[model samples]
Target: MSERVLIAGCGDLGQRVAQLLLARGDEVYALRRHPPALNNSSIHWLCADVARAETLSNLPAGITQLIYLPTPGGREEEAYRSVFVDGLQHMLAALTESPLRRVLFVSSSAVYGEHGDEWVDERTPPAPLGFNGKVLLEAEQWLSTQPVRSVVLRLAGLYGPGRMQLIERLRAGLVHAPRGHWANRIHVDDAASAIAHLVELREPQALYLGVDDTPLPLNELYGSLAALIGAPAVPEGPAPAGLGSKRLSNARLHASGFRVRWPDARAGYAKLLDTQ
Candidate 1:
């Protein structure tokens, strides 16, 4: 059955999710503090700051699903709390007054902290070490108490147009990596598609770790990306102090019957270069 979906924080990822839902024949209402650069005529765009409940109070009725992609500002813990934690509280309060059924919260895999080359799955207990990770964990806890059924997707490093960290480093000829350090990532499209898939299937109260199937050493991934972009590969330097390496297992998401469009960094990089 087609349903009305509300997408908060309609940035790159949120906008892509809105596009996918609209293409699937679902009614999508995108809420953003500012207008996004989207060209879709079918989407209903609303200007509202989710940081305040008053802005979200008058949402159109019958929203079956709500996607929250909060934007954290400032570096301090207090700032993160105000935007992520406080804003979520306001959103939850507003949703409680509505008939929203499902919610998808986009979180970061940094919630796992530095795992020292260890593999983490959905079953792993959250051990967030950094401020960002801790803030997200706090937001996740706050969302858990809300009445709506929710899915928290702890996404790995995000990469796509205008957001590829590796490409940015490579273009600057400043790829730096300590020996033996590795990390995982998922393209933005795949992340958005996964959310669309879950919403379409009505999966609730589940946590999914969204990551690329392949984990690459920092040096190799940077080198490959530079090669693809026709840029000179930068020499590797000593690994950064305290950098931990870890691989993420996406078997659960795959088993859920959603295949990642870019299963590995290599494939994603190839497409990125092709489109560039």
Candidate 2:
């Protein structure tokens, strides 16, 4: 059956998910504070700030599925809270009476603190080290208490198409990575597909880690990416703050039957570099 889906805080990832849902003949209503001109004409765009409850009062009725994919304005606690925790609260309150069946809440793997090369999965308890992960975990817990069914996908680093900040850094000799820290990532396309997959899944689990099959050391990842793009070697530096060394496992998501197109970051980066 076709579904009427509402994507709150629709941004890059949300737009991608909308395209997938549209291709499957589902009705997609995307809500954003300032919606840009869309390439897909079939998408129904709603201009509203998820952070502002008043603006979300008239969301589309009968939204069978909801995808919350908001990006924080800044790295501060207030910024994360406004978007993830408060924004989700307001969006859900507005849709309190709608026929919403499922919510695919886009979260981050940062919720798990440093695991020191240990494999972390859905079964691992979350120990967020930064305000970003802390707030997201709070939102996830809050959503679980709601009456509606929900799926929280804690994504790893995203790279693909137009996401070339890291590549630019490598080219500029500003790139650095810790030799011992681990890194996890997922291509943006695969992340979008995972969102679409879980939304339509007959029976979905409560939480899943959205990541590629391969987990590489930070230095190795940077080195390979630099070589792939014919850029300068990356310098050994401190690992990204608050993103502890950990190898994330996507076994549960794979068990659910959704396959990633870019299972390896090297190949994924190579394909992306080819177009450069």
Candidate 3:
């Protein structure tokens, strides 16, 4: 069943999500701060900032689903509150007024706080310690109270193309790993695909942990990437005291019939390095 989809914040992740929906023959209405640089007839680009209620009010009616990908300007507490909390309120307000049935909010796994080496699943309580995590938690809580059918995807560190933070550090010869500390990651394409899957299924008020299958020491992952790029591996240090180490379980999503194309960091890193 094809349905009209409206995407708020059609930036990197949002644009990729739009592309996926377009390829599937769905009507895609993407809201961005500016017009897209590329010419794509399948996407209807609307210029509007999601932070403003008035801007959201202008959204076309009869939208079947909505995807919120609002950007947190920085790690500052104020920034997170303004964007994730306030912006979400505005987006939800408009969504409530529309005939939208399903919603998918792309949240972050940071809501887990620092859990050392312990696997976190959808049932784990959110213990957001930092500003970013707190803001996302608040937004998720706000969404949970709404009547609309919604799902919150707590995505791990997203990597691909221009968004590979760790890979960029490795490429720039700035790779430094804390000993015994591991990191979770997922490909941007996979993230977008997960969002699309959730939208299509219209999962109600559910929470999903989006991450790759492999969780390796931060140092080992960097070494692998460095070797792939024919660069020397950077030195490693002791894991930070407060940082936690744990793998994220993807069983829930997999059981839901959504499989990650890049199930591990090695496979994802290979593709990213191959492109370079």
Candidate 4:
């Protein structure tokens, strides 16, 4: 029996997960607002908005697995709540009738508010520094109460492919060495692969911290990237702070039998530069 997978909020990462699921012979239904331009025969792109219960009328029936990875539009409190809290509530209600087996919810590492270089894992309590983390934590709480088997991956700063904000900032000279900061990231492909791996697992833990083995400080990470692009590295000095520093651990994710293709920022950035 083929498992019918429903990917809610099917954006870039969702698209990659869809490709992975299709390649593994699963029936994937991609739910999104603007229709996706993908041409996979095994995947179905349904026009529906997760935030709006009215639009999710024709969802595929009997979804065995659910992937909820909605990207809130703006950086405001209302925007975050609308997507993470209210939006999830609406989707959960709509899917109550469907036969849901498992759920893979993509969350952010922003939930941790620590600014120091402390190593945080799945067991560490999340104290989000801003509304972003607060709302995501709310969503995770709601997901935890659900009856379906669920795995919530609190992902670190995501980077790869068309999502090259770090590289863009470095190239534009907008990013510089911080006085001292820790930046954790896992390549976007690795993230997608982890979700795909969990989908195949007969049993998985309720939560896993998603990040690479390396947790480099801003100065070293930026320095390596600067060298790769042949750009001058910024000297250590006063830098604006965002998402307080903390080392995110992925030991739990790795134990699940997944290896990152791009282990660190240096290797990942070098791969991107080669393609440029």
Compared with the true structure, model 1 gives a TM-score of 0.91
Best-fitting candidate, scored by lDDT? 2
Candidate 2 lDDT by residue in tens digits, 167-272: 8899888988987899999999999999999999999999999999999999999999898778898888888888889999999999999999999989998888
C-alpha lDDT of all candidate models, in order: 0.80, 0.92, 0.81, 0.83
**Model 1: per-residue Cα lDDT at residue 158:** 87
Question: Which ranges of candidate 4 are over 4 A from the true structure?
Answer: 37-41
Clashing residue pairs in candidate 2, if any? none
lDDT of 4 by residue, 1-276 (tens): 568999988889998999998887899988887875766566788887777888876677888888898877778988888878888878777788899988888898988886587889998888987888888999999889988788898888888889877777777777766756887888899989988888887779999988888999878888888778876676776544557888888898888887888788678878887887
Give the winner by TM-score: 2
| Cα lDDT tens digits for candidate 1, 38-73 | 654688988888777788778887788888886765
Better of 1 and 4 by TM-score: 4
Model 3, span 50-142: residue lDDT tens: 666787667888788889887766667887787678988888777676788877888987787666677788988888766677788999899
lDDT of 3: 0.81
State the TM-score for model 4. Answer: 0.95
Model 2 alpha-carbon drift over 4 Å, by segment: none
Which one wins by TM-score: 2 or 3?
Answer: 2
Is 2 or 4 the stronger prediction by TM-score? 2
Q: Regarding lDDT, does 1 or 4 come out ahead?
A: 4
* Candidate 3 clash pair list: 116-244, 116-245, 117-245, 117-246, 179-237
Model 2 Cα displacement at 45 (Å)? 0.6
What TM-scores do the predictions have? Answer: 0.91, 0.97, 0.92, 0.95
Clashing pairs in 1: 117-245, 178-239
